[model samples]
Target: MRQAVRSQFTAQRAPWALHRRPFSTSYTRSGYADTLRNLRIGSHTRVIFQGFTGKQATANARDSLAWGTKIVGGVTPGRSGEQHLGLPVLPTVRQAVEQLKPDATAIYVAAHQAAAAIEEAIEAEVPLVVAVAEHIPLHDMLRIHSILKTQSKSRLVGPNSPGIISAVGKCRIGFQPLPCFSPGRVAIIAKSGTLSYETVASTTRAGLGQSLCIGIGGDILPGTDFCEALAAVEHDPDTDAIALIGEIGGIAEMEAASWIREYRSRAVSPKPIVGLIAGIHEVPGRVMGHAGAFTALDEPDAKAKITALVNAGVTMVHHPSDIGEVLREKLQGGSSSRQGILSGLGFGSQRRQMSTVSRRHRTSAQRAVPQQKRHLYLSTAQSVGLLIETDRTIRSGSPAATANSQYLVGVGIDRSSRMPCIIAGHPLDVLSEGHLKRFPFDFQRGPVDIPAEQIASHLGLRNQQTAIDSLSRIIKSLVTIFYEKEAFLLISHLMETDKSLTVVSARFGFDDAAFRIAGRHQQLHEMRDAAAEDPSELEAEQSGIVYLKLAGDDATVGTLVNGAGLAMNTVDALARLGGRAANFLDTGGKATSETVKKSFEVILRDERVRVVFVNIFGGLTLGDMIARGIILAFEELSLTVPVVVRIRGTNEREGQQLIARSGLPLFAFDSFDEAAAKAIELSRR
Candidate 1:
C-alpha cells in the first residue's frame, strides 16, 4: 500500500506544480502514525509517579504499570526509603531525578500542594509533567503557567485532567480508564476528560484505533491548548488523523481554529481534522460540570466555533459517535480525489474534501449500479434547509441501448435556515453567504407559505403549476422513498424563471444523512440493527432520541436519560469515578412508563451490561411516570445487576415514593454526582 501510494504521488507530478506538491497518500494512512509515535511520549520513555503514596496516585500508578508504562520510580515527601508496587520511592522530585533520571512525572498531589509539586518538577527539569490535582488556587496556576511559558523547561498538561495515553505505545499516565481506549493511528486532544473517553471509545468501536489521547484539562487556564497539542500531533509519527473535542467554554477551540486556518494557508500538506464541540443544545451561562465550561454570550460557543472550523476546512462531527466513521472515510482514500484536484492547482493541499460518491437507492440486490455525484453539508445548527444547483446528463448502458439520461447533482444549503433550493451561482459561495437577502424569503422562520406564483415570479418562472408539476414528478419517483422507517422525506424540483436552471431538494433525518448522501451501502446495512420496535414505543426510542451502542468486546454500564447533554454528563462522571459505559440512550423529551420499560428491556438484551444507570430530568415526562416505568422494566427483565437511578424536576416527591415501594434492590438518588459514584462502585463489584 505504501509503495502504491508513493507511486501515485510520483505519477501525479504535474511539472508546473512541483512546488505545490501535497502529501503522498501513504502520509495520511501510515506515515503519520510513525511520526507521532516518535514526536510524542514514546512507549519506551521512563515515567515517575509524584505523590506516589496517595491512594489515587497509587491506583493510577498500578494501572499505568499494568498497561506497560515504564515506571522507573516514585516520589513522596517522606517515604524516601519505602516502595510502591515494587518501585522505589524518594522524598522529592529532585532526589528521584538524581536517582532515577525519569523522562516524565505524573503528579497526584493534593490540590493546594499541586503548584509546589509542579514547580519542583520544573525546577528539577523533567521533560513533561501531568498534574491531576484540582482546586489549585487561580493565582498559583497563573504562576505555574508563567514558569512554563518563560522559566521552565517542562511541558505541563493539567491541574484538573485525566492525563494522557498512547494507545499503540501501551503507555498510560493519569487516571484515564484504559479499557475504553484501543491501539491505533488516530490521536485525540480534548479539554474535557469524560468526553475524551467517549470519543476514544467511539473511535475504537469504529475500528479506527487511537495513537495518543490527551485530556488537556477542563480548567480556566489549561497549561496547553489545541494549537500546541495539534502542532505536536502534526509532527508526531504515530498519529494519522486528529479529533479535536471542544465544549461550550473558553476560546481554546477558537484559537485552535485560527491556528488550523493559518497552518493550512501556509503548509504544503495539512492533516485532516475532525472537530466536535459539545453543548450545542446547552443553555447559555449554564455551566456543565467542568469549571471552565461556562460560555459567554460573545464567545464562539458551539455554533460559532463549528461554523468557523467548517469554513476554515475542518470536518465537523455533531456527535461523538460520528468521529470514527468520518476519520475512517478520510483515511481509507476517500479524501484522495480532492487532494488530487488541489495538488494539480498548486494549492498545496485542500482544507476540506468535496463529496464525490453518488447515492445508492438501496442495497437489497446484487448488481452493478451507476455512480452518482453529491454535494455534502455538515451543520451544528439544530435544523437545516438548503438551496441546491443541479443539471441532467444522458447515458446508455450499452452501445446498442437507446439514449437515456440521469441528473447531475450539485447541492448547497443556506447557513442560517439550512433550506434546500436552486440558486443562480456557485453552491459554496451561496452557502458561505447563507440565503440570498434579495430573494426575500426565510425558510427557517416557519412554514414555507409563500405562494407558488410569488416564488415563480421571484425566480422569473412563467407558470407556478408547471414547475410544481415537474417537481412532483421527480418527487414521485425518487424523493418519497424513505431511508429510515420514521424519516420525514420531502423532495422538491425547481426551475429558473428564465428556464435556464433546474434543481431538486430534500430534507433528511439528521442521523445517517451523511452516509445516505455518500453512498456508503455497507455502513447503511450495519445501521439496521438499531431500528425501533414500533412507533408508539416513543419513550424507548423517541424521534429526537439518539442511541449510540459502543463498540467493545463487552458492555458494563448502560445509560438511560432524557437529554443528550445529561447522557454525556453521566458518561463523564462514570469515567472520573472509575466506571465504563457500555451504551447510551437519549430519550429526548417526554418519555412514558412504557417507553422506560421497553428501553430497559432493550438494554438488558446486551449480555455485557452488569448495571444500568438512569438519570432523568423530568419536564413533559414527569418523574412519577419515570419511576413507574423503571418499576415495570425491573419486573419485566428480572434484572440481576444493580440499577442506579437519579431523578429530578416535575413530580419529584411522588416519583421518590413510588421507587421506595418497588421492593427491588434498586438504588435511587436526587444528585447526578452521587448516583454516578454509586453506579461506578456497584459496577466494580
Candidate 2:
C-alpha cells in the first residue's frame, strides 16, 4: 500500500506543472437571466433566424413564433429579401437588427458557418444569442466564449444546444417542445438537451410544473454551469425548489453542492434543493454521448456525486423520473431538515435574545441561583450538547475520522474524555456562525465526525473561545481534503462504471500521447506486443500495419481508408451502415500512392473485422482511399480480395469512373454505403 501510494503520488505530482488549468469561467447560471433581464426584452424582443431557409431552421422558427416568440425576421445569405416562415429574409444580422431592433438572435447554422453567424449577431449587438450548431471546433468555441465574456451582459446559450424556456413568462426561445412544460414552482436545469425534455415530461407527469427549464448545453466548455444556475434558482421567488440534472463530465456538480451548502448555512430560510445526475452506466475515460460527459479518471462519478449530495442533505435521485418524486416529497415535507436542526438549536428564533445576554453574565447569574446551579442542571445541559454534536457528525459522514489520529483531543468543562458532544447532521449548519460558537468542539457535521479529542489537540486551547478557533481550522482542513481526495474518488468511480470505459480509456491513452498516433498506422504484431507491455508504447513505435481488436461480443466493421478527412467520413458512413468502425488506422506518409495495397491485406488479417469498406480519396497518394491498396494486393497475391470500395478525391474522377465503367468484380459506389447494402452485396458474392 505504501509503495502504491508513493507511486501514485509521485506520478500525480510529476505532471502537476503540465496539467492545464481547467477552464473555470465556462459555466455560468447567474449571467443567463441577468443578461436577458439587462437586454430589457419586453413583449417585443423580436428574434431573427440566421439559417431560416433551411428545413430545420424554418421548422424551429415556425414553432418558436407560434409559441409566442417575437420572431421578426430571418437571414439566409444569398436568398436576400426572400421570406421564410412569413418572416423577411434580410441576408444579414445587421440589416435585421437595425430594422427590427430585436433584443435577441438565434442562429440556426451549420457547424462550419456557426462562428461567422455568431460574430454577425455580436456586431449587431443582439443582447441574447443562441447558437444551435453542434460539433463546433474548439478554437471557434474559444473565440465565441472570449467575445461573450467581454460583453458580460450579453447571453449566449449554446454552440450545440436546445436553448432556454421560461414557463412563467410563457417564452420558448429554443427548439424544445413547449407544450411539454407548464409554469409552476420547480426550475429544471440540466446539461443535456434531450434529458431536459425528458425531465420536463416527468415533472409535469408528477404534477409538479416548471417555472423555467434551461439546458445549459452539453459541450465540454459550456457558457453556463451548475453553480451559476443554482444561484438564479436560489433567488427566484417563484421557484419553490430546484431540480439540478447533471451528468458525469465535470466538477460542476460537486462545486454546486459546496455552494448550496454554504448558501443554506447563511440563508434565513433556504428552499429545498434536489439533484439528479445522469450517465451512471458510463465507463470511465469513455465519452457517452456529449463531449462534456467525459469524466477524468480521478474525478467524482455520478454515484459519488449523488452520495455527496445526499450526505450534504440535498435530496438526490439517480433517475430523472425520480427527481420529480423526491422534489415533491421535499416540498410536501415543507421544512428542510437542515432548517429544522438550526431552529431546534435556538439559532433561528432565539438568536437575538441569546446574543444580547452576555455569556459570562448568564453563566455567573445561573451559578448564583442555587436551583440553577444544581448538579442535574449542569449534567443535563452538557449531555444535550454532546448528543447533538454526535448525531450531527454521524449523519454527515464527517472526514475527521481520517484525520491524524494523534491529533485527537477533547476540551470541555468536564475532564472526563467521555463527555457527550452534540452532533449536527449537516456540516454547513454546524459550521455556521451561531452553531460554531455554541457547540465548538462538540459539533460534528459532514462525512466523518471530528472527534472532540482531535479538535482539542489541534486547537491547543483550554477555553471556549480557543475551542471555537480550533473548530474553524478543522472545518477548513476537512473541506480541503474532501474536495481533493473524496471528490477525485467520486469522479473515478463514475468513470469506471461507464460501459464506454474501454473506448474512453483508449481515447485517454491517445490524448495522453498528445494525439501523435491518432491518425497514424502501426504493424499488427508489433502493436500487440507494445500494447501488451504498455498500450501507450505503441504510439511511440509507429509501425505501419494498424491493429484493432473489438472486445466482448460486439461485431466490428473493418474499414481501410486513406487520409484523415476521408477516414472520418468512412467512420460516419459505417455508423449509417448500422455498424461501428472499431478503430481509425491510417497508413501514413511512408506508403507511396502506388504501394497503398499492402495496408489492405494487413487490415484484413483480423477475423474480428467481418466487413471491410475500402474508402479512398486520391491525395498525394494517387489511387482511391481504398482502391490503390486493393489493386496492389491483387497484383502481389494474384487473388480476389473481397471488399466494398467508395473511391473519390484527386484523380478518382478518372480512375474510379473508369472502374465503374469497366464493370469489374469490385463493388463501387459514388455515394457512401448509406444502407450498408453494398457491403452486404460483396459479402454475399
Estimated TM-score for each candidate? 0.48, 0.47
Candidate 2: segments with Cα more than 4 A from true spot: 1-44, 334-685
RMSD of 2: 21.3
Off by over 4 Å in 1: 1-39, 335-685
Clashes of 1: 23
lDDT of 2 by residue, 533-572 (tens): 3232133124443333333344455666543223433444
Question: What is the C-alpha lDDT profile of model 1 across 1-685, one tens digit per residue?
Answer: 2243223223433221222212111112332112322227767778998888888778777878888999988998878788788989999898998999987899988776788888888778777788876546543564455444343346777866778778998887777657667888888998766557657866887798899887777665676667778887876677888998877655567667777888888878776888677654333323343445545212344555565566567786544555777788888868523211112221222223322111011111112111111111122121112222111221112111211111222212211121322222222222222222212122222112323333334334455455544432232222112212112222222333332324423333212322332333343334342333223232333433445555455448887886444465555456546677776665644478887877787677677778899987654457899999999887877778889987765576789889998888889996566787788777767
Cα deviation of 549 in candidate 2 (Å)?
A: 12
lDDT values, one for every candidate: 0.57, 0.49
Cα deviation of 385 in candidate 1 (Å)? 53
Worst 10 residues of 2 by lDDT: 487-496
